[model samples]
Structure formats: C-alpha cells, structure tokens
Target: MKKVLIPKRKLPWGSDHEAIIWLMAVLLVVGMVNVFSSTFITAENENSAPYAYLLKHLISMGIGFVLFAMSWRVDYHKWRDWLGPVALSIAALLLFVLAAGTVVNGAKRWIYLGAFSFQPAEFAKICSVMIAAYILSYRVEHKLPINILNAQYAFIAFLFVAVEMEPDMGTACVILGIPIVMLWMAGLKTYKLQRLALVGLAAVVGMCIYQPYRLERIKVMFNPWSDAQGMGYQTVQSVTAIGSGGFWGMGLGQGLAKYAYLPEAHTDFAFAVFCQENGFVLVALVLLLYGAFAYYAVRIARDAYDVYGQLLAGGIMLLVVGQAVVNISMVAGCFPVVGVPLPFISYGGTSLMMTMFSVGVLINIGRYSRAKQAKEKLDELRRNNLKNHEAALAAMPGRRRLQRIK
Candidate 1:
C-alpha cells in the first residue's frame, strides 16, 4: 500500500483582517499627530508642556494596544457567559457616575481612578451590543421568540437613562441606537420595529425639550450663522477651520484655529483641526480610510461563522462607523452637536481603549470564521480523496469481483 499525504492548510488570513488592521494603524498614527498639532497651543496656554496632551494620548494608546492584544487572543464566545457579571458591573458604574462622578465641562460622565478618569457610558455602549447579541442569538438558537420585553431592552434602557442623566446626550443616543440597529438586524417584525422607531423618536423629542440647550442646538444645526457667537459658535469655528484648509491645507501645526480659537479642538473637533492642517486632499484620504474600514467590517459581519458572530460583528461595525458619521456630521454643522468623538481620532482614553477592545473581538471573530471555513474545506477534501481511493481499490484486481461473489 502507498501512503497518501494531505496538504497542510495554513490559517486563512483574508483581506478583511488585513484591511482592518492597516486602517486602525493609519488612523491611530494620524490621530497621534493631530492630537499634538491641535493641543500644543492649548497646553501652552494652560502653562503645561507643549507635549502634555500628546503624552497623555500616548499613554492611552499604549493601554488600548494592550487591551487589543488581549481581546484578539481570547475566544470571543467567553464573553457570552460573562455578560451577566459584566452587565451588572457596568450598571453599577453607571449608577455611581450619576451619583459621584467627576464633572467636566458641565457633564458628570467620568469617574476618577488614581490618575485616570473612566467613562462608564463607553463601556455601556459596548456592553449593550454584547447583551443584545447574546440575547438575540440565544433566542434564535433555541427557537424562541424575541420579545421586546426581554432583559436586553430593560438593561439598555437603564443605560440610556443613566447616560442621559449624566447630561451626555451624545453617548446616550449612541447607547440607544446600538440595540435598535441590532434588533432590526435580528429580524424583528416590521410592526414591532415601527413601534420601536416611533417610541425612540418620541423619547428623543421629549429629551430634547427637557433640556432647553438641546433645542437650541437643533435650531443652530439648521442655521448656525443665525447667531454665530451664541449657540453656533463651535459649529461656525469648525466650518471655518475645515474650509480654511483649502486644497493643500495650512500645513501641520500651523493652523490658526487651534490657538484657542476652536473649543475642543483636540477632542470632539479633532477632525476640523486635521482638515485645517492637512487640507482637502488629506481629509479625503482619511475619509477614504474610514470608508474602507466600514466596507471591510461589513464583509466580516456578512461572512461571520455563525449567527452570533454576524450580529456581534454587525453591532461593532455600527458602534464604530456610526459614531464616526455622527461626529463628522456634527462637526460639519449638518447635525446638532452631540459631542460624539471620532473613534480613533478623539483624545479620550476610555473611548480609545474600548474601541480597540471591540476591534480586537471583531478580528478574533474573523479569525474563527476563517478557521471554520478552512476546516470545512479540509474535511471535504479528505472525504473526496477517500472516495477516490475506494474507487481505485475496487477497480484494481479482484476487489469488485470479490464483492460481486459475496
């Protein structure tokens, strides 16, 4: 008998994974450069070292990279079992933030831990996706109906209210938007979805009216120049910086807007500063990177190994890309300023860490999907080879004659 050897298969590393990794690296590098360029003047004005904010951003990036590595190495399925404790811990933190969180810029959204401040709402957003993905995937797996009255909705609602109470409407809206998008993707009935949409709309309107400033922001979104020095000040400055970049930009770190002219130049409006310093060409390139990210993320989601992975990847996609869209629109004066930070470009430690963690999980899912596909291919190949070997044996000598005689 002759020995048969099956070809060794390498773990598949598709373009989707490569694209995501490259996109993240490029965006992080751009973010680091823009963070320094945008914040140096502000740091000097505060009597701090010109590199102060850049150093802090670097520290956050280091922590985020650690998280990303851990998430990529761990099995994403473990998160399904840990959801209960994770949700409880996040809920408690949200409550604690409401009670005694550090106040910054009139928003009590952070809790100080040693030298670092933590934002519970950021965790809540990712947790909400996990919760929704787990619940919906479980129900579908068990052949159970996905009712609106499930614990997933309850927990998400609680998170939304807590974040809103923190007076951080931008994050609250993001928290709310995550599950709704997931629910739709989960194949909820159209009627239920419509009802949910109506309720969401009503709640948004009520929340806006509850805060007079929110209404003002909405009005200013439509006509920012109506009162340029009042509610529209940030919008006007953001637009000016973006437009001033012209075709080639004013050159990095040379933009005049970041010299205390535009508030939150390093945080919420980091894109504006980047546009001002890098010009339309670089802005277009950056936006193309984001667009490519979204495209590859969608590919990963659609090709996930199972229903759970699909939903999980889809939720993460919405979380990152959706937030980027909202932030860019707000900065462009096309939407109300909701203070949402651009994903990798924003200078928030917790946000950058959580986002990196989510991307890590996504990458893990992609790896699993590829592995499963490779295993399937190997199994099919083995089966086909075995069939061929059996046919050859039967065709040789008296194998078929022996069977006929029997």
Candidate 2:
C-alpha cells in the first residue's frame, strides 16, 4: 500500500475544481461578446452609449465575482444553521418586490432602489434552493417521509406562487424545478416523489390555465411564424436569426438580428445572438461547454463529504442547467418564451450576481470534495490505530491483573 500525504488546503478565490472555474470564465467572456452584440442596437436606438449595456453588464459581473469570492471562502455549513432566517428574509424580499416592483414589458418583477432596479425573483431562486436543500437533507438523514404537502415543500410552493403572481412563469418553474430535482436525488422513495411530482404538475397547470399571456405563449410555440410580427414576433425573430447562422455563423458581432430585430437579444434569447454570430458549430460548442460543466458539477455533488454538500451542490447544478435548457428551448421555439436568462450569459445585473453567488457556493462544496478522499483515508488510519492500541491495552498482562484484583 502507498502512503498518503495531507497538505494544508486553501481556497484562494479560484476553486480547486478547475473544470468549473474555467468553464465559468469562458462563459463569462462569451457573455460579454454576445451581450455587446445583442444590446448595441437597443442602446443606440435609445440614444445611449452604444456600449452602455455592455458596461453595465461588466459592472454587474464584477460585483457578482466579488460575492462569488466571498461565498467560496465561507464554509458551506453556515448555510445549514442559517437556513430558517434566510428563508424568511428571502420571503420578505419577495413580498416587497411584489408590493413595489416596477413593471417592465407588462411584468411586475423588479423593485427600484434609487437609480437601480432589481428582480428579487432571481435571488429568490437560490434562496429557495438553500432552504429546500436544508430541509430535505435533514429529512433524508432522519428517515423522515419526504412528503410534498409538508411545510418544507410548501415553502417552495409558496415561492412558486409568488413568482407566478409576478407573472414570471419562466423563473417560477426554475424555483420549483431545483427543489424537486434535489428532493428526488436526495433519495426520496419513488411513491413520495411521485406525489410531489403530481402536486407540482397541478400547481403549474393551475398557474398557467388562467393566464392569457401564458396561453398566448403556448400558442406561439407551435407556429411562431404565423403571426410574423405580433404575438409570435419574438419566436419568429429568434428562429430567423438561428436559421440565418448557416454553417459557420454570421461571424462574431456580424449578425443582423440584434439590430433591433430581436427584442430580448441580450437576455432570454441570448443564445440566439450567439447562434447568429458563431454559427451552428460554435453554437454546439457552447452547448457542449454547458454539458461538460453540468457533468463536473454533478461529479462534485456525488463526491461531496456530507449530505448538505451533496444536496446543495446538486440543486445548484440543476438550477443552472435547468435554467439554461429552458432558455435554449424557448429560443428554439420548442417551448414558449418566459423570462429565464441563460446562466452566466444574460444581461441582467441581479441575475448575473445571484448566479455567480450560487456558483460560488457550488465551488465551495467542491473544494471539500477535492480533499475528501485523502482526508477520509487519514481518518480511517487514525481510527484503526486507536482501536489497536485500546485492544493491546486490554490484553496487557498488567491491565488484566489489575482488573482481576479489582
């Protein structure tokens, strides 16, 4: 057998998990290029600086990265202890937004804070995950029934309803998706998981059944080009830009769709801008990057040192990848457009910052994963040595003689 060495471990802003760190870096760069392309036309039309959106996105990314570093350095265990108050705080913020949110494009999802406005729904998604994971991990550990109607799951349901009331059905789905995925992966039995799924399905259906905007979106998903310039206009434009990419894309920054043709080019439909500029080949590459990131993120979750890390990291993996899938599908017209931003690639400051913060949490969990195997081995060695020493003492002639005398 080979000897093992345990070195002092440190988290220095960058993760020990290089795959996640580099993948995020590449995606942020891609976001900058595509965000500029997507927003330049909108800025120019508004008579703002052509790079204004790009600059704002940069500042947002900067702030997000700082919080990312902070989260990475902090211990993941603190979240478990803080879960309840954090959940209540997030709930308060959500209510505050609902009560005071500024409307944009007919959606009441953001609150104005002086010169800046933000969507609390974005941060609420992460908060929901932390809360759900904390509760579910405990349930799994204690062999409690992971029931859907339970208050733990009800908190998630409450969040979903709050976001849906904001009419941001896209984000509402994600807030729900992350927890459901986490619950299933945390080893909730099939029958109970099924119940949770059914309840979730009912909630989703009920939320959508009465909304006119949602109904219109569903109709557009099937034949987006039918309306050409009305209800289907966004889908039509997105598909047009993607189809125009041909074999090698229109070349970076050369796409025509972002010239005020695609309304949400820098946000929900960012992938379309990327497809328009980078072509099918590079578009596939971007998807592959997301794929690889998801794979490694899951690897981190599987190898984590504890249940909390597993649930926390796994839910985040679902949150980022799930949101990406929704945005891509929406752009491709396979699903109706809702306001889900491509993780790490969208133009929204709050969205980008919160996402980075979550990624930081994932990275923190991964750091323990990297050192876990070696640490476990060392622990096993110490246990075996201690047991052997105790046995030898018990068997010693003097110890036996003393026990007999007593």
Candidate 3:
C-alpha cells in the first residue's frame, strides 16, 4: 500500500510585524542622514572632527540594534516576574541622577560615565508601562477592583516626581501620561479618569508656576516673535527653518540652519533641520511613515494574545507616537519647546537604545500573537478533516464491520 502524506504547517508572518520593522528601518536611516547633515558644521566650530557626532551616533545605533535583538528574543510575559526588581533599580537610578547627574541647560537628567551618559528618565518611562501592564492584568484576572491607590499609581508618581526634580517636565509629563492612558484603556471608571486628569493638570500647572523658566516657555510659545532673540529664539529659528523648506527644500547638507543659525539642530530640533533640508514632500512622507507605524501598532495590540500583551503594546505605541507628535508640534511652533527629542531621529544614545528596546518588546508580542493564531487555524483544519473522514466512513458500506475489525 502507498503511504499517504500530510503537509507540515508553517508559521505565518504577521503583516503588522513586517510593517513595523520596515518603518523603523526607514526612520533610522533618515535619522542617520539628518544627524550627519545637521552636526558637521557645529562639530567643526567646536574644534572637533567634522564627523564626530556622526561617529558617536553610529556607535549608539549599533548598540541599540543589539539591545533590540535581545529584547525581541525574550518572552514578554516573563516581564511580569521581573517588574519588581526593575522598578526598584529605576527608582534608585532616578534618585542618583537627581543627586549627581550631569547638568546641561539647567537640567540634571544625565549620568556621565567616561565619555558616555545615561538618562534614567528614559528607562523610567519603560518601567512605568511595565508596572501598569502587570498590575492591571493581575487585577483583571483576579476580578479585583481597579483602585487608584495601588502600586501602579505609586510607582508612576514616584517616577514623575523624580523626573520632575530633574526638572525635565517634558519627560515627567510623558511618564504621567503613559499610565493614565493605560488605565483608561484597561476600563477604569470614567469618573476616576476624570479625577486623575484634573489632578495631573493641577500638578502640571503648579510645576510651571514653580519654575519661572517654564512659565517663560509658555509665554514664548504663544508669541515667539515677541522675544525673537531671547527666550523665543529657538522657537523662531525652528519655525523659520520649517517654513523655508517650502515644497522642494534646500537640498541635503545645503541648509543654513546648521551654520550657528539654530541651536541643538541635531538633538531636540533635528526635525527642523530635516524639514529645512528635505522639503515638504519628504516631510509628508516622514509623517506618513509615523502614521503607518501607529496603525500597525494598534493592529498588533488589538490582536494580542492576552490582556497584558494588549496593554503593553498600547502603552508603547502611545509613548513612541505621542512623543513624536509632541516633538514635531514643538518644532512647528504649535506647542512649547519642551526639550523632547524625536524618536529614532534625535542624537541621544540613551533615548535611542531605550526606544529600540521597547519596540523590540512590541515586535515579540506580535510574533507570539501571530504564532498562536496560526496554531489555532491549523488545529481547526485538522479537526475538520478528521470529521470529514469519519463522515465518509459512516456513509460507506459495511462501515461498522470495518470499524469492529480495526
């Protein structure tokens, strides 16, 4: 008798996963090119090699990719077990930064180790998301109440206050916003969310008033031209760069903004340099890539295998895309200059590595979800085939006699 053959089931690739990888790759390339273009003049003026910033950026990218791979290989569910230690470590680091971090432009937000610096607040953002995911998922599974006085809220507040003391209100705002958004998505009561919103608003308002510089930023945001050469200088320059790009741009490496015309052109205002050099057409393309990223990120979260995965992906999506929105708006004069860097495009080692790590976790969740769905599909196919075979046997002559003989 001839042997019957069955086909092996193959795991399916998720479109969302593929799209995310491509989008990230494109953004990274854009970031590399822009960083080099925007910093060579400044590097030369500072008595450094023209490619100094570019080389450092390349090193950071290399390290970031390695971290991305490691994160992608780890099981996201295991993060629940590691949350406690990670949160404690982050808390310690934040305290250390406040005590002895490197000061730049009046903010103590970095810890210098030799030639490299680390930002605890970036990791703080990651910890905030993980804490919310673990606690919210546990509450949901145990059928417990979603109280506002849980460890989730405590950790978020701790991170917020620590980062705020770094005087990085931009990062502190982001840390606070991440968990509140996650809470709402996890089905917290509307009244509770509203209350949280009001408190957050009050905190932000008080913080602004406490710092005279922050209030000055708000005033300059509304009328950058009023103080064109003072507090509003950066904003005015950024808007001018963006507006001068017009439809076709000034061409690569040909922009005047980097000639001592715009401060921090390669860091916080990198997007402004990009807009000035690449024109409105490429700007639109960059925006579209960000839009596509958000779309696919939402799809991944929606199709996640469990609640924790859903919330994890959702929080990360909000972090990356929300930060991008705020950075772009700040550059375009739609929002105050808050020192928020554009993800993947800004030239900061700590920010780049942490962003890539978070994205890797998201991709791993997508991969697991895709595999689960494919396995379910394959099992259903096998069951249906078995049912059809049994029905055929029942309809055949002497089916009972054949079954008894077997």
Candidate 4:
C-alpha cells in the first residue's frame, strides 16, 4: 500500500488554542523541583552527587520534548492504518517485561537497558488509547452494531487482560476506561454504555475480593493505624506528609519525609513529596494546571475535524486525566496504594515520553480543527461573493437589452 503524505501546516505557537502546552510546561518545571527535593537527599546520603537524581529526570524531560515535537509534526489520523500492530507491539512488550523484567520492590514492571529502565505499562496506556480510537473510529464510520459481544470490545478486553495479568491493575483500569470513554464519544448510546459501566463496577468489586493484596490495601486505607509499620507504612507516611504541610510546606529540599521516612519518594509516592515540600498553595496551583490541561484537551476533542480525530483526542484525554486522578488519589489517602505516577511529573522516562507524545497529538488535533474552521469560513465568503456577482451580471443583461431597443 502506498503511504499518504499528510501536509504539515504552520501552527501559531502563541495562540490560546495551545493553552495545554503552557500548563504542561508549568507542571514539568514544578515536577523537576519536586523530584530533585525528593530524590537528591537520598542520592547525596549514598555518596552520590545531589544532582544525580535531578539529572536523570531532566534527561527524561529533554527526550520527552523530542518525542512531543516529532509527534506534532505527523498527522494523528495515519495511526488508524496500523494501530493494531502498534498496540500488539505494546502488549508484547508488556508480556516480555513480565517474563524478563527487573524485579524492584517485588514487582517486575521495568525493562532495563544498560543505564536506564523503562516501564512498558506506561507506554501501553497510550497504546491502548490509540487502539481504541482506531476501533471506535471504524465502528462509527460503518455504523456497526456494537453489542456486548462485539469483536472490537472483545479485542479491547484482551488488551486489558494482558495488562491486568502484568499485575499493574491501576494502569490496566486506565487503559480499559479510556476506550470506554472513546466509545461513548464516538456516539454509542447511553444505555449500552451504562451496561458496560455496571459490569466494570462488578469487576472492580470482584478483583478487590479475589486479590488479597488489593483487599489489604483497602483495609490499610480505612485504618492506617491498624498496620502502622507494616503494609500501611506508605499510607501513613503519605498522610503525615500532607498533614504536615499545613497551608505552607516545610520548604523545598527541607521535607522530613524524604530523609528516609517515606518510601518511593521519587516514583509512586512522588506527589506526597510534592505536597510536603511545596505546601497546599503550590499543590493547588498544580491541580489548576491539571484542570487547564483537561479543559483544553476536551476542547480539542470537541472541535476536531472528524470522528477519528475526535476519538483519538478524547481517548488520550481520558488516559492523562484518569492517571492523574489515580496517582493523586493514591497520594491523598483516598484510594488504596496503587503505584501509578503523575503524568509528566513522575520520575519515569517512559511515562514522561508517552504523556508528552499524547499531548503532541492533541495539539495536532487542535491545529487541524482550527484550520478546518478557517477553510469553512473562507468557502462561505467565496460562495456569497459568487452569488452577488451573478445577480449583478443578470441585471447588466436587462440594462443592455433595454438600451439596445431604445
């Protein structure tokens, strides 16, 4: 098959249409400071340079920018052609990591490559969105009968199964939920979607009961004092860090929790460190930035030129927003200890790159939407001018005939 060349248009970088970019930039800068505060102390105590932790995160940010810029240059619609293969590659990577991954804190989620490690689950979240967007776009185009046993739904279920078996339940849920959102946005009826939701709620309940660890985490959430120094330690530390903030934080780099008190200060529980170091005010600012990002993403999805672009942007919006909620909930003690990281803010290279890439796609959708609107306005004006010109030409014929007769 011949490849189609998607013409690239120059986008106005300073336009308000790109508000998410500004929000993301602020979040990224704040995350760098928080990661440094959380990780540098530990690195320094171990005779490593204080900037070692900061350097790694900065490097991830640099790489993420490259991915973002590259993604923006391409038309997101092209992915529809081979989203299946892309998704299969991500799923295969998930399985591969499960079999030959680096074991850290009893979970084999990381694939190490020389000096750095990457989490396949992180990229899988974005891939799930891409796959779902493709399938939903196809269904909407063909007006397929999408019942409970639909093949597209089954295929999406398979992706969820692979992710869940990896034991990364949080990411698995995000991956599954994003597609549901995309399907809804693609014009699925509410009653049909409600049935899916009911089933999802049942599955959540069943999983909590079946998985002892998940149930234990729930118990720990309700009564942090019960386990104290056991399974509940992370929760207790996180709560204490939040409570200690008290309107204003202990100040950056001065958080007591990072001094060997809180575990996973740079990864799963990074938000707790953020709260401890930056206080409620800065935390509020971060939340505001997140809200802005969500708002613009939804706008992009709403304004996209076609169903495919809309679904793609909408699916990605769900992934980022859903992950942020899960990560923040884990930190705020509202949910069980799910090891999900804040998007663009966490100290993981894979997560950062995937998120930035998704943002870049949304930017492309916004650009296309704007361009299409401009073209429509121009066409409308041209049509109006042609009609007026035709009226003038008709009147001129009558005048000429009258003058000739006279």
Per residue, candidate 3 scores C-alpha lDDT tens digits across 1-406 of 9998987645333379878888999999999999999999999989999999999999999999998998888999988888889889999999999888899888899999998788999998888988888888788878887766986788789899999988888898888788888888888988888898898789768888798888898889999999999989999999999999999999999999989989999999999999999999999999998998899999999999999999999999998999999999999998998868899999999899999999999999999999999999999999999999999878877967688789
Off by over 4 Å in 4: 1-16, 397-406
Each candidate's TM vs. the true structure? 0.94, 0.88, 0.93, 0.91
Q: Candidate 1 local accuracy as lDDT? A: 0.90
Better of 2 and 4 by TM-score: 4
In candidate 2, stretches whose alpha carbon ends up further than 4 angstroms from where it belongs are 1-16, 381-406
Error of 3 at 397 (Å): 5.0
- Native-vs-model 2 lDDT? 0.85
Ranking by lDDT: 3, 1, 2, 4
The RMSD of every model to the true structure, in order and in angstroms, is 4.3, 5.1, 4.0, 6.9
**Per-residue lDDT over 205-268 for candidate 2, one digit per residue giving the tens place of the 0 to 100 score:** 7766777667777887899877878889999999999999988988887899888888878888
lDDT of each: 0.90, 0.85, 0.91, 0.82
In model 1, what are the clashing residue pairs, if there are any? Answer: none
lDDT (Cα, tens digit) per residue for candidate 1, span 1-406: 9999987756333468767988999999999999999988899989999999999999999999999999888888998989899999999999999899999999899999898788989999899999889888888888887666886788898999999998999998888788888888888889988898998889878987899889999998999999899999999999999999999999999998888889999999999999999999999998998898899998999999888999999999999999999999988999998879999998889999999999999999988898899999999999999999999877777967788779
